[model samples]
Target: MAVLPGAEPFRHEGGEVGVLLCHGFTGSPQSLRPWADRLAAQGLTVSLPLLPGHGTRWEDMNLTGWPDWYAEVDRELRALGERCSRVFVAGLSMGGALALRLAARHGDAVAGVVVVNPANKVHGAAAHALPVIRHLVPSTKGIASDIALPDATELGYDRVPLHAAYSLRVFLRMVDGELPQVTQPLLLLRSPQDHVVPPADAARVLARVSSTDVTEILLEQSYHVATLDHDADRIFTESLAFIGRLAPHAGKEGTATVG
Candidate 1:
């Protein structure tokens, strides 16, 4: 399949530390390309993979579900671990849920985690209907480009595949329960006025996670897609600092690294 214009996966080889960046559901690596580039500029190897069934059409995404999406990032993390002495996983929204899962499943292999407007639990009345509605309705309006900036746009499907969304809900439930197993350092960035994910989702993560080092930042000017919004630089800068703090010696001069 031909990938969309800005939706290609991104990879950068830098120092001995690696950072895995994951895009949200229905969103391509385009959403995190700037983030990936910024980290690469800091001399950190980065991997921003386009999730399975994403970076293409909505109907195509409807055929694949959360397992396929999670598998893509999971594989990327293992590859990074083999090359870099230390690795950190981060993402936006559903991608954040996936990052948490990685930290949970991989344990000490993941040095830290950074999540922006992560969705850990599905809520609202409409969400409850997802299980049944997906069978009747193939898709609905998209939930992308929720930026506070007037002209900012996130590269994602115009429609939200109901089947994929239902699977996301199920996937989040599993992540929520697995939160207690995530013991790595965590950095959570949240948008106060996010329309898609409520404040409660971020709260739940803080309450459930076992990480002793947890930091939360409020993006007052951005919305759900904070990565492409007004506070984008803030997310990028803070995340780099988080990684540096966790892996201080990994980026020193003469450190060896692999692809």
Candidate 2:
């Protein structure tokens, strides 16, 4: 299947500090392109990978599952770990869950974690029925591009693949169980108005992560896709500050160190 224009994975080899970025479930890297470019401009190496089963039609997502998506991001994280002295993981929505999983799994290898509207669980009566519903339904309404800015859109499928969504739910629960293993510095950004993920999701992560250095930001003007909404610049700027604080010599030109 042909990848949609602007949905391609992005990589920039810039400096000794690397940031691995993951896109949300069913979402292409297009949703994080500007965020990646912003970090790249600061001379940090960046990897924004298109998760498996994404960047194509909605039906294609049904052929894949959360493990496939996690593997793709994990590969990028390992590649970044090889080249950079410090590596951080960040993501939006399901990508956030993946980022936390990386932090949990890798321990000190991940220097920090950042997430925007990270999802950890599904709710409502519908969620309770997903395990059975997925066996019968192929898809339902998509929960994409939940941005407050008018005319803004995300390059994701128009429908949610039920089986894939069920996989995501299972994956999130797995991450939730491992949250206490995450010890890296954490930055979580949440939008109070987010329609796709509840505020409790962010709260739960904060409560579970073993990291003492955790900061939470409220995106007053955005929604679930806060990276592309009005608070986009704030997310980029604050994330840069977070990275610089942790890796002060990150973008400096003279070093070729890897840790």
Candidate 3:
């Protein structure tokens, strides 16, 4: 079910703990690069992969659906399992929804999940009233100017594809339905002033997930894209601590829950 045809498995040369980083919608692996590097420097092998149909022409992204994106992350999770004693999965925005799905499905294989500004539901009444009709209407195009990324970072697609947004709505529904099954240790981080995903959406996930070990951190200075914002380093630091807490004991190394 892998999305990438003939793509080889990801291998880590070192590190007993592995982290898989998933980016947001219309976003490339670049959004997670800085966070991945930080984890790698901490001796954890990290994989920040380009989702299917992403990091290319925007039209390609419009062609793919959420299932394809999930398949891609599932494959990476499998590869990470192959290389480490413990694995943690995390994502940003739509990536957060994907991360939650991974934890729900791979409850045994996954050590934990860190979700940053996970978009689970659109709160606006207008968006809710005409969900289908809105997809037919085009919105003004432009990525946020204060995305808080270095000039070299891939900000996002300038033009928001209607079909792509519709696809995300479908995925959010998928995540919402599966939230109760996500019982793994979870860290939910949200930007209070997020313009894209309402903070209440994050609260909904926190409220529904069955996990008892859940921590919610509010980013005062960041926007929706917390991975690249002012609080990004805090995310990395907190996530590292979360992973460390779940790591297998040295004497109990190689002990992991199997699906």
Error of 1 at 241 (Å): 1.1
Candidate 1 off by > 4 Å: 253-259
In model 3, what lDDT does residue 73 have? 95
Q: Estimate each model's TM-score.
A: 0.96, 0.97, 0.84
Instruction: Order the candidate numbers by TM-score, best to worst.
Output: 2, 1, 3
lDDT, candidate 3, 150-257, per-residue tens? 553444666656566667778888889999999999999888888788868888999899999999898888877777778989998898788878884311332222
Q: Model 1, 232-252: lDDT tens per residue?
A: 999998998888888885455
> RMSD for each model, in Å, please?
2.2, 2.8, 5.5
Give the TM-score comparing model 3 with the true structure, all chains together. Answer: 0.84
What lDDT does each candidate get?
Answer: 0.91, 0.92, 0.76
Q: Which stretches of candidate 3 lie over 4 Å from their true place?
A: 1-12, 123-154, 248-259
Per-residue CA lDDT of candidate 2, range 31-92, in tens? 99989988888889999998988988999999999889999999999999999999999999
